[model samples]
Target chain A: MKKLSILILILSSAFAYAQTPEEKGLEIAIEADKRDQGFADSSSKMTMTLKNANGDESIRKMRSKTLEVQGDGDKGLTIFDQPADVKGTAFLSFTHVLDADDQWLYLPALKRVKRISSKNKSGPFMGSEFAFEDLSSREVEKFSYLYLKDEAVDGEDAFVIEVRPNYKYSGYTRSVVWISKEKYQPLKIDYYDRKKSLLKTMTVSGYQQYLGQYWRPDVMVMANHQTKKETRLDFADYKFKMGLSERDFNKSSLKRAR
Target chain B: MISKMIKTAVSCALLFGFSQVKAGEWSGYVAAEYRGFTQSKLDAEQFDKSSLSLSFEPEFYHSWNGGDDSFTFVPFARWDEHDPQRSHVDIRELVWLHVAQDWELRVGIDKVFWGVTESQHLVDIINQTDLVENLDGEQKLGQAMLSLSLIKDWGVLDLYVLPGFRERTLPGKDGRFRSIPEVDDHTVYESGAKDKHMDYALRWGQTFDDWDVGISHFYGTSREPRIIPTVTPAGLRLVPYYDIINQTGLDVQATFDEWLWKVEVIHRSGQGETFNAFTGGFEYTFVGVMDTAADFGVIAEYLYDDRGSDPAVAFDNDIFVGGRLAMNDAASSELLFGIISDVNNRTRFYNIEASRRFGDSWVLSLEGRFISAGSMGGPFSSIRKDDVIQLELARHF
Candidate 1:
């Protein structure tokens, strides 16, 4: 009887060591989030090139500023600087963990600040391949994760995980992300539509270190699988600890944005 | 004339300082439009059955002193082949702005917009309505003012000291949207200072969570003039009587996922009798409909007034329903269709506006408006036969 009891204990301990896919996925997400903390604020300039299936291209230039929040989602603002038609247009966003993000748009032609309807998050951003939600700060709490498996992407070992958005009005049903094992940064993401069909694939490359601690990608490309369209964002002029505050991210500041 | 001289001097100064400026921007659009009326010419003096128009708006921005101080100049002009009233020129914006850490100061003519409702802008009263530009009253004539905006942790506060008043432009006799009796350009003022009266306005706005709220107050000459009939040498003309009034307004919007709720209310005093009006609406959007990169939005609103049918405004008691479609394509195609109906009468107004970009620099737009048979004495009674369709092509530079 004593030998049988000891055998049962040994088997239970082995079973407890094995984690479910969901738990493992969540653990990986938590680890990534932990690694990305302490970036108080940052500012950068980006140029986006959009290409159609016909290989036609258009470019847009914009500047972005972000403010990191403790125990909450971050805040961000983007100001369009080029494309004369959209010049002086600004967008402000306040992301939340468990709630819909707040967004406002300043239209230079009208000289008015308009609050963007939250349901429009799934819409395209400035006619680009990216959605408004995609441009926002991605909080770990905004999704539920499921670990898929370990995969190698471009000769680099990566962990594949699937994330389902927890918010309503999401245009995508699920997204599979490839996180590099070295930096725990997102290497690539595949978005799926409501029908669970592949919609778009986004790849991040050209990683650069800032402040000797933070890693940021200098180039991101998103290709629409169904439409055969693509958008490439080239980032530069990264400045961290810019001292951005909530006052700089308000509607009034949108008018003063240059 | 003095304003023109000042503008010239400012232009010269800007040109002289252009070499020292780090950056500047210039943008404008030239548009040509054709309007076709559903009805033929009513009289020989009236405009032709169809008309063509051209408009141009050029804007220039120059930032100096390391972007802390800037100057913006936007001049607009339009020419109509048939209606002289529609052929006009105005300075849309000419402002010198100074920005500080927590406050901003702007002086000169500028346009200010405030409100959240789609059907009507009840709380937007800073600028005078440019009536001849559009029948929907969405266009505004710039006003000269000294504005100071303060930013704080609680909210944003804006104070305006308006000095010059812009008269409402009225369509000429040959125009399509004129009243039965044309409005006289000569205006009467209830205030002793007439157009020189220094108007004042204040607004406080803030956003918290999903809610955006604003409260504003304006005290000055009313933008909406009372139409009084006067016997002229040939016929009776409607003269505008600008009354001194005080108005308080409130606007609020709440965003919840895919839904937006908006409300605008206003109360005005000193127009013989005080009156209150409100407009409330909601917009719901469905994104990526049918697996395509298209969005569809449904909008509904209710407009009410304390005086009901006897109210001065056109939308005293009405209901509006609209739908917006966005293609989310490279061309940025959009279409909006709406209908406004009288709650107590058999009056309905339908509108459809569609626009799409041809390329990086060109855009084309089409608009149609129809009015159904309505009871007498309503706002649309005079223009009920003026259903029209318009097409416009614009080139941006």
Candidate 2:
């Protein structure tokens, strides 16, 4: 009888060692988040192209600077440089973990800094297929993950995970992401609507290593299945560790963001 | 090598007193506008209801000292088909800015706007109004000043020393939108130095959580001129009288969820009598309504002024309600409509403005204004026939 009890204990210990899919998913997310850290600050220029169902296209040019805030989310400033009507327009944001972000908009025509509401998550950004929430910094705590399975995406081994937004304001019910197994970077994401129907698909490509450690995507294209519209973001040269500080992200400095 | 010599040359030029500065970039827009009035001109001396105008605003910018110091210049001009007074030119901005670790210094002619309410700007007294540009009073001529701003964790305190003032632009007798009795270009000032009288202002602003507050005081010549009707040598004309005044203002804005609340209050002494005026409003926005990719915002504000006895200033007590629609599309189209109605009388004003980007470098804008010309017989009596629909197409570079 004593030998039988020892065998049962051994079996129970083995079962405990095997993690559930949720736990495994969270472990992968933590690893991915860890790899993206230590980039003190970054600056980049990007162009956004929008295409309608009829294949009509429009382009936007902008420059962005981001500063990493220790123990919290990042601070970002974006200045619009093209589409002449919006030239010199600037936007400033301070993202906080588990708290609402602070946003400010600077309009060249008004020549003033105005505090804006950050709760408009479902709204499109710059008339693009990307929603406002999609452009915000993605913290590990913002979503809950569930490991679906392992799949090969475009002949590359990747892990498929389903993630549901933890925030209440997100327009997406859930999203399915394909994370490259080797690089721990996202290769594609499928967003679902409130009715649990697929709404948009985003594919990322052209990964470039920056700072000898950081992996950044050169292009990300988001397509809306419902409207048959698409928006493509083409990133230009990205400079990391630009020595940016808190003073550069303040509202008063928005007028000089360029 | 060549690069090292060029770097040394740049450093030497910087060491000297800017003997050679880098060439600045130029950018601006040229707009052509057409205005069609709904009614005929009110007076025999007025011009035709159909009007055409062309406007240009060019900007030049240069930066140095690792971007800590910079200079900006913008010049604006307009050419009217009719009314010579409407054809004008002014310096919009020509300023040099220096930024230090905690403080910033700005000198030269600059355009500064200070107000929170949407119905009217009760505390925005930094620049003179370019009245001839439009009756909506959204344009201003630059004022020369030296400003110092101390930025601290607690708040931002700004001090200004204004040395020169630009006279308010008035409409000519032939102008379509004009108050009866043509205004005399000559002006009388209570100050001994006239337009050169020095002005001083200071403002302290801070943000707490979701609220932003600003308190300011200005002791200078009032931007609004008192139009005193008198029989001049030419005829019965309105003479503009400038007065030195002391004004204090407070503005606050609170942002919560999808709602924005704003209020601006001011107390002025030296115009005619000491009085207090206030304007407050709120805006609530709905995003992604009706399964469409558009955002709609509803706004309402109350305007109050105890100086109703003054005939020159209207909208003493009014309620303004408005709506804004932003179509989230590739064209980036937007529309704004508002109505301001006097509480004491039947005076009401309706305004509509819409704009959309055409391509990479072009935009189209439309504006329309309608007035009821109610019991308020001040400026409304003259502008009753000035209801106009304006369209502008601009090409930017």
Candidate 3:
């Protein structure tokens, strides 16, 4: 009887160990979120490709400086390329925690910057397939997450998690995410629209270690399922912890930005 | 649809004379186009133009179901060859309306246009003509209006008050073709009475099974200037005032089976002069074109002015014939061909254009125009028109 009891305890310990794979995947995802949560950095260039319902594709390239202060959200200067009339114009956005974000766009011809409000977020951006809401910062608290499963990504184990947004204005309802177990970084996410249908798929690639403890993705791609339009963000020449503050985000300082 | 709370709120507001809503629908479109002009006259001239135009067309299409209300604006502009093309922008419609079961109230910028003809002097007042049809035309979006109607099985009776508009400035003429100037805040005439900007009109129309017909009578202020300053026998400029201005007209139109016809006659009271015009046109579906549906249209018009107005302003009083040919299919966005011949001036204008659509978001257009003759002289002094070519890419949401 003593031997039998000892054997049972040993089996229980083995079963608990076997569940570590999934448990570890969850921890990695949580750690990755923490890493991104504290990041404050700026990037220079990004290219986005969009896929349409017909399988044809369109590309939107933006040349801009993006300053992202995590938890506090992202603010940036964006310039559009291609259309001659809209060239040289600039855009700015500042995301706040407890309130709606504020945005502004400078039209060169008008020679003035116009403040954009909540009413206009659903509208198109310069007649592009993208909406103003799509460009705003994604607050971490805006969503609630649930661990779904574990799977291999690129031959490495990953954890699958589903997140549902809590915002009312969001065009999407839920997103399914795949996070790398070992690296504690998100690999891909599938966005579902209001009808709970797959609307867009976002992929994170080129994961690079920054500051030894930070795992940052060098590229993020978001593709719209209906419009066949995509946007790609390529992080380059990132400078972290430059002592950026709220003073730098003022409208008066935007014009002096290089 | 008005909700139960809104109905209660609206009722209380009406009872207390409260007006204005914090939320309303505002929508508009803008066009910036570039074009080169080819002259058909002697000393053929070429002009190139890049224009940016914007319009704010807000419509209050919805109101208290039983309340009389009105609001709409359609403003537009076109810069041509470094000068402002005929500016057609205006506070097109602003009506104060009261609605009762049997009677509806409407006041301000209201004109009833009823005609099937492409160019209707009689019914073209309500809406501006499609831009593609008139290359250089004076269709200013002007006039003050008042209309009252009783809705019926056929149509409604509408009354209006019309206003003479400040003449829109066009291009190609000295003092005419000037860069789009900032809009004037005010203006006065030489009569010491300022611009006699207001008049009145009454009209009625009915519609039946794809057919609509209407007759309208207008009594309004004339746009014709009463005084002209000219150089006289002594090499001195003198001002002459003329009262030969008639300020009344009649208009009629009908539409059926995609075909339209219209007629207008204006008789001056002082000068005993008359201006009459008639127009007919139609659009038809052309099948068996590359297995996709195609369309084509044609228009012809005639004019007779007993006054024989000067060649300088064809819109005032003159005889001319013009027609348009339009074709569209899966192969192209819109293919248009057109010709206009001035009978009195002995000049002609023609153009061909092709436009294409990209994805469902953008439009790319290519167009060219040719003028066989512009100036009367046939040599170096004559107008040698340069081909006007334009390429416009636009995206709308």
Q: Which docking band does candidate 2 fall into?
A: medium
Query: Each model's TM-score?
Result: 0.92, 0.94, 0.46
Residues A1-258 of candidate 1 have per-residue lDDT tens digits of 999999999997776578789988998999989888988899999999999999999888899999998977898889987665677889888888877778888988777888877677678887899988777777888999999999989998999999999987788999999999988889999999888999999999999888887889999999999989999999999999977777778888787787
Compose the digit string of candidate 3's lDDT tens values, residues B236-256: 332323232333445443433
DockQ of model 3 vs. true complex: 0.01
Instruction: Give per-residue lDDT, candidate 3, residue A103.
Output: 62
Interface Cα RMSD for all candidates?
1.6, 1.2, 18.1
Rank all candidate structures by their TM-score, best first, as comma-separated numbers: 2, 1, 3
Candidate 1 Cα outliers beyond 4 Å, as residue runs: A1-20, B1-23, B309-312
Better of 1 and 3 by TM-score: 1
User: lDDT of candidate 3 vs native?
Assistant: 0.48
Candidate 2 C-alpha lDDT tens digits along A1-258: 999999999997786578788987888899999998999999889899999999999899999999998888799999998877788999998887767788999987657788887877778999999998888888899889999999988988999999988876688999999999888999999999888999999999998888888888999999999999999999998999978898888867886666
Best by DockQ: 2
lDDT of 3 by residue, A1-258 (tens): 999999999997897677554454444545766766655655555554544445565555565555666556577667765333334367777665435555656653223343433333433444343456555665556556677778877777888878765654555677788888767777888877667888777778898876666676778777767656565666666555665554445433332232
